[model samples]
Target chain A: MMRKTRFLAVFLMAVLTACAGAGHLSNWHDESMDFGAVKTVAVMPFANLTQLQQAGGRVRDTFMSMLMATGGVYVLPPGEVARGIARAGIADPTAPSSEEVVKLCGIVKADAVITGVVKEYGEVRAGATFGNIIALDMSMLEGQSGRVVWTASAEEGGVSMKDRLLGPSGKPINDITVQALNEIINKLFK
Target chain B: MRSSTSFLNRISVFLITSLLFLPGCASVKAGPAAAGPVVGANFRVAVYPVANLSGARAPLKETRRMLTEMLRAKGMAVLSDEELETFLARHRIRYLGGLSAEESEWMKGEMAVDAVLITSFEHYDEVFPPKIALTARLVSTGIKPVILWGGSSALAGDDSEGILALGLIEDPGRLLEKAVGGLSDSLTGYLSGKEERLKGASWRAVVRRGTEETGQGPPFYFTAEAEGGRVHIGPFGPKSYYEAPFLAPGKRYSIVVAPFLNASADRDAGDIVRLQFVAQLAAIKNISVVEPGVLREKMLTSRIIMLDSVSLADADLIFEGLNADLILTGKVEDYYDYQGPNGTPHVRFSVSLIERKGGRMVWTSDSSNTGDDRVVIFDFGKIRTAQGLASRMIRVIVEELFSGPLIQERPKGVS
Candidate 1:
């Protein structure tokens, strides 16, 4: 009887532990919009709000690379996007207005556009423990209508209990970045 | 018989001794012919003070001393620093970025200088993986100073890393020497009628993203070579339609590079990029890039200030002042260098070539890069400095701008 009780306790704890690394994810999808119609997509430079200098561009390039790897969508070249931004006279590429989005999409001939913001990137510490973290929020807009068809957010990496007790063995920033972006990408496709 | 044997032995000893000393005599005679400058035949080059456009403090004295020594080593008669100083002081010449027409005449008549070399120092970093960027142009010292030769380059310690980083350069002094040595070699090559040509190489990293319906295979193609490893998987073609047709075969054109606009955080990034482009453009045999100092002087005298993009009227004014066939200008979006172990340099910029006759953009290109862009593994192809990255980027863009079939029809307007 004691063994059974212990087994149940351990199994319950295991399930909870697995759920810890899931991070925070909030997603919105428009049921009225047809996602199948979207083909080529353009990713604008992400807006960075952290102390990290190029956290925005770095994350955007990684997310673009991962998205391109999935073979689910065609991502326009960054140079093409830059050319569109230049021609459209978009002052701020990170946070373009709906009208600018339509014009940029037309210029690049992209079916959709994705813009993102990096809230937190780099090592975060809670006194005794330290760990890498990345917080990313993205929105996909319909090229023709310039309306948000889908939006998603994801955060990954933090000080775990093992880390606190065993001391911090921080992961490479790139790995944490890939994890965060992968989670968001899965959510987008799902 | 014994006397005859003694005579033969003496003759044998004398012949061996003579042969041993003959090579030493020959080498002593060959030294000047092979390496030293020929008296009265060498070009008398006067290297001016380095123009600082880096927006930061540079080791100008040290750099100039090294460059002058290197130029002299290449069998050119470099003017002594003392003489150069005396002349500048006498003429009260504060600006050394370029020589004006009057100054050129003075140099030819009074100094008997055959050519004047103007240099611009762009970026110098003494951190790990030491880096240096500079451009030099040799112009004829006459009433009309025409650029006879020019070269711009950047060097970093970790640029040519081999297995386990065996080839990485860690000394800033060695790196500087290599950078200066390359320019001297190029100048000597030109003087000897052997123009250096760049081998064909593609700098673009294409990533092909095939849709699910196409049923394409893998997402990337990886190739590991002996020099530097590269991984590319993407659609093959031009990234954008930014370029317009440029250049006619067998025709030479003169070009003026206007100051670039800096949107990047780095100070004077615009000027750094402008000088880099000028350096690359001047090296082409068919194109003559005006000395940037000349252009700067003209702009100052004409009271022309370009707030943003160069206006049509401004272009006309520049054309009138320089009488050049084309005007090259652009903006630098990002020029950043990361520090520490995982650092990588990133640079992004765009350029456009405008026709003086019709005021149309004849060629345009946009380039962005990072040090770790295409490294498959082991960081073989990583770049460590923004200057080095910019040099590679500009070379590729210039090659595309000048090479290829001539397009007779006027390109459609950029939308």
Candidate 2:
């Protein structure tokens, strides 16, 4: 009886740890962002892998909102650089050329630019039944070097679509955004 | 007099040769194809999921062998087999998992993979209680797969077309072979459109009809080089227009680069623009899409709404690009009913319509019955009719968009 209880305890701990939190589970992989004496970070328009057009902008806003809210890193507002793109006539706003990224940095007046392609977003559906799944990818880069300091992608397959579809309006990927920040925020400072 | 006549004849011959050869060289060499600075000519391609059909797992050996053969047929120096394995290890996936556009760009920039193809497909049996129909769809990571024209078939084992057997039908292998052959044929047809043989660098384009000189329109006459793509002028036509070659999935790096250099040449590229727009709209149709293209076209034009579908991989790209007042995107998915022992009826269907925004989705109605699944076994026609599902999704979505910022009037010409 004592041995059985001990075995169960170890198994339970393993299961609990898996379900504990994003950081604990994510530490298996080295997903950290380091600014390395760089202060200002220009968050480029994140890629939109979803069907939604504004997804990239929202991701940009979320990163901006969360980071700016933290009062740690200086974020460059897209509105400030919209003019430069318009002037350069980059028809597709999201797909800024490397030259364009550099030019936009000049306008934003930032030391580094954080930009990456939005890897994915979608729902898990069984026929008409719904399953919640939301995913995002973010990368922070230095403006001058165009080198990525940190890159991370997150995907959530079991998002609990039942709750959102059944209950009131709610953001499905808010936790992803929060977790994304938490995953890299400290690493950048360090 | 004989010497003067001979001299005149020699001069005439010389004049003719120069006339033909000089202009040919000048026109061919004058085009922007020769103007742009050479960017990264040595393109490195990260052929992920090379051996797999879609992002999902499949029999690696057979499928990959076939896919590699196909790429080799295209003269693609795709990364060697070992390189593909290394890439898979780096990306942390067993297969390529179908890189998204952003991921493709990142790959091109980081790993120097000029292009990437992400794919997903399902090979399953649809049981209509007694009858079983087998189908497969090769979907791009983000866009709906181009049905390859022949992936869907109406034949079963025993080589008896349209006959559904009780047990696993006889000659199941041959039946699938026929289906795949048909599918490959269609994919070839679609891939033909992606061929940039006549693709050019000039910004100018014309929608030409057949001329009297040649009975058929768009006929080729001679061989010439246009931008990065090769142009063929057929023996049939006197007139042929110039165009930049279309971007084929298997080969895009060489094509995309030329356009980047002479930006003006591709600025008004109607083909690229139309295809990109179609890509945007096609996403909607693939994501649990049931409606005919007509309804989508009508609703799209009549509203300030931007619409499309997204796979799990590209949720971020779609989200970022679609920062309109409202955005609509979802996925195409299905479920299997494994009740019976070996004969589980696979009700194949695409169910998706989530990740909505603008605080819409005001209402939703669920209709998944316990037994009924993706394959409407008995109701064959009903199940195939996408309007039942796709349109309903649109109705909910349309109603939501029109609710607020998707307002019809633009605040009395604030402009």
Candidate 3:
């Protein structure tokens, strides 16, 4: 009975998160190259905005899962490209531009690239209330386009450490990601 | 044959019932319970040591000294480094963690010590301001080290540049003094109790309900919570003089809402007084809504969320910061007392809320509710219970303002 209740709770949370996602994603451009035509696409390293900060590799991992889970696409290894950048002695480890973007695609030999800026990642704590919010805006281009195609971004906002550890919250992190991914996918499809 | 079987069942049921009641009776028997002051054989602790974690050349002497002095002041016969070192050597104990019960027994046998306190300071480097990080802990033989208190504080040191450039505080003596003192006081209250058990791990949270600085019983204060042998409630950090003691975490506890009367009474009177206050506090939305804090997490989840609990000092500083949309205040007036024809006691309480803007009260609401109206009465005299009073108060207050429509916006669940 307890396990059943837990399962029901998770299902309910997913629904609520989907519901909340509709509000934040309203912009972006998806250059309509047939995603169906491309079996595998390479996602280049993302841009680090807002002064200089490292958000760990979780951001990259999240994008990988979010993109693949969208269907009709597959991602090449990010590790191989990271090695190429290292071999090339890239001065900046966090942010890469158009030239580096091209070089990265060549190293991985893939269809396209995705890149973006991390707008904010902060933890606001006051009294007994604690809130963690992470927001980023991303763009996907034909690896060499220098022309932006699909761009969709979303903000994950809310209070964590609530009723249950990793419980249903005002705004869940995963929900926000799915919302942004859906809107971006719509543009890609369009 | 049927009568015999029925009689046997009754006897079995009676025996089972007695087994349950006996524990309850022993719990409340009240025979000068001997658990407070950590006499000789207590075996749990959290030692938070804040030092230089930042790879800077700042002196950690003052912080280290403050720790030893503070623990000593708390009246625990703590072990010195030499003694701790010798004991560790004797017991062949290295890496102070991951010890089995047999290993623990060996250590205790060899060292004659049940637990040891270990802490380290992290991240001490600050360019303009003095940033200090401390980790305090208390570890026993088998239990994992619980962090009693660990956080970094930036004392406005020598940088006169103010907010742009935080200055390291010239003397952290006072700040350390207050933080330790508050922790000590909270520990004392938490440990002062008689314990009985049923279920998972438990701890006691005690907040002091009292008069304001104006000699009027309005704003409230809190003592730190003692749970599972760990103390929580940020050491009033830089604020020293208003410290409470270290607390004990026990499942069974008595929460004295308003101790204007005897704290020992387990009857309706105590609970009645508590309920009246809750109803009053809840009527004002900003004053208390969807209560907060991990320590107070249980309270908000309770049928009644405690509201009339902001002390004058805390409230004053909070309002002075000009942070809240509006400051709120509340008070309890006379209780309606009468005799029942059946020789039962009945009580009712009155309270009011005042909103503070600028320097004066801008809005006020008066409310009163009978205690016995909600819960049925069976006896007289000491007639209050935390649950009974809190429930009545919660019902009244939540209905008036805690509803979703009344709030500014639906608050996202607070972590």
lDDT by residue for model 1 over A68-167, one digit each (tens)? 5454676665555777887899999998889999999999788999999999999988677888889989999999989998999988887666776688
Candidate 2 positional error at B30, Å = 43
Ranking by TM-score: 1, 3, 2
Off by over 4 Å in 1: A1-190, B1-40, B53-57, B161-168, B197-241, B405-415
On a 0 to 1 TM-score scale, where does candidate 2 land against the true structure? 0.29
CA-lDDT, candidates in order: 0.69, 0.34, 0.37
Candidate 3 lDDT over residue span B1-415, tens digit each: 9999999999999987765454323211111111223335353333323333333454466565665676566565555667656655776654432233444455456555554444333223333323233323333443221112111122222312223323224344543443344334333332433221112111111211113224432122211111111111221000000112112233221111222121222233333343233223323222222111111222233323222223223333434332333333232222322222112122222221212232222222222233333344542212222222333343333322222221122223411
Best by lDDT: 1
DockQ for every model comes to 0.12, 0.01, 0.01
DockQ score for model 3: 0.01
Better of 1 and 3 by TM-score: 1
Docking class of 1: incorrect
Error of 2 at B272 (Å): 30
In order, what is each prediction's RMSD in angstroms? Answer: 12.3, 27.3, 27.5
Clashing pairs in 1: B207-B234, B208-B233, B208-B234, B208-B235
- Kindly report which residue stretches of model 2 are placed more than 4 angstroms away from their true locations once superposed: A1-190, B1-47, B50-58, B74-79, B90-95, B100-103, B110-114, B121-183, B194-334, B337-358, B362-415
Per-residue lDDT of candidate 2, residues B340-385 (tens digit)? 2232221111111223232221111111111222335642222221
- State the lDDT at B304 in candidate 2: 22
